[model samples]
Each structure stands twice: as C-alpha cells, then as structure tokens.
Target: MNKIKPGDIVVITHNTLPRLGVVLKVHKREDPTKDIARVHLAKHNKAYNFLISDMEKIIDKNT
Candidate 1:
C-alpha cells in the first residue's frame, strides 16, 4: 500500500458502506499500525480520526 499523506484521497468503510474523504492530517507513531489520520468527509462536512490501517488510499487515475 502507498503511504497516506495529507491531501490524499482515501476510502474508509463506515457501517459497512464505503465513504470517500480527503486526508487532512496524519499522526504517525512508532508502530505503523497505530497511525491515525484525520480525514474530512465532504459529503458529511465533518472531519474524523480513523486508523490508517482501516482506510485505503485512492489512487488518482489521471495522475
């Protein structure tokens, strides 16, 4: 998997549904699995912290 960074787009499974969001910040820890990311959900207009491992980075096809 690619390393998730701020401004990257990602998808997270919420309540069994996939939600897309932009990464606002990433809090890295000594243990990579413990890393967390603050993502802004445009559809919901809210930001939430989610475990990095729980989210998948969305690659831009145009890039």
Candidate 2:
C-alpha cells in the first residue's frame, strides 16, 4: 500500500457513511509501523485522527 501524504483527498470509513476529507498530516507512532493520519473534514469543519489503514485515497472516477 502506498503511504498517504498530506494534501491528498482521502475517504474515511469509520462512520455509517463514508466521509471525504483532506489529509493534513501523517504521524508515525512509537510502534513505528503504526501510523496515523490527520484529516480535515471540511463538511463537518472538524479534524480527526485515524489509523492509516482505515483510510483510502480517493481516485478520480474520470481516470
């Protein structure tokens, strides 16, 4: 899996409905392999932290 970078649009699936957000930061935890993604959900006007594995990069449907 490719590492998610800041500024990339991502989809968070932890809710009943998947949310779209822009990644603000990628943090490496003490575990090294356990990374976290900081995302800004514009619709909700909130920022949240989620496991990197729980988010997916949004691909353009036009491509």
Candidate 3:
C-alpha cells in the first residue's frame, strides 16, 4: 500500500466494534520507531487518537 501522510482521513476497520478517524502523524510500520498514527475520531460523540494500520484512508471517489 502507498504510504499515507498527515492530514489524511483514515477509518478503523478492525476490532469487534469499528470506528472512524483521521491521521495526525505517519510512521514506519516496523521496529526502530514507536509513534504510529494519531487519529481524531468521533466514537458515539467524542474524538480520540487512533493507529495508522488500524484505520484506512477514506478516499473521496466522488471527486
């Protein structure tokens, strides 16, 4: 998959209960680095951070 950058919109597709969020940062998906993606999501009504791989970029195909 192409590498995603900050500001990209991502959606969490895992967990028994799924949610959506945005990417605040990007990191290599391996050792040597610790920080993953920082997502701002709205679960029920509150927003929070989420991982990169844990979510998918929401591509606006309507453009």
Give lDDT: candidate 2, residue 24: 90
Candidate 2 residue-wise lDDT, 31-60, digit = tens:
855799889998899999988878888853
lDDT for residue 51 in candidate 3, whole number 0-100: 53
Candidate 1 vs 2: which has more lDDT? 1
Could you tell me the C-alpha RMSD of candidate 1 in Å? 2.1
What is the C-alpha lDDT profile of model 1 across 1-63, one tens digit per residue? 788888888999745988899999999999988999999998999999999988988864336
Q: Which candidate wins on lDDT?
A: 1
Q: Which stretches of model 2 miss by more than 4 angstroms? A: 30-33, 59-63
What is the descending lDDT order? 1, 2, 3
lDDT of model 1 at residue 17?
A: 84
Better of 1 and 3 by lDDT: 1
| Candidate 3 lowest-lDDT run of ten | 26-35
RMSD in Å for all candidates: 2.1, 3.2, 3.8
Of the pair 1 and 2, which is ahead by TM-score? 1
Clashing pairs in 2: none
Q: Using alpha carbons, what is the TM-score of model 2?
A: 0.79
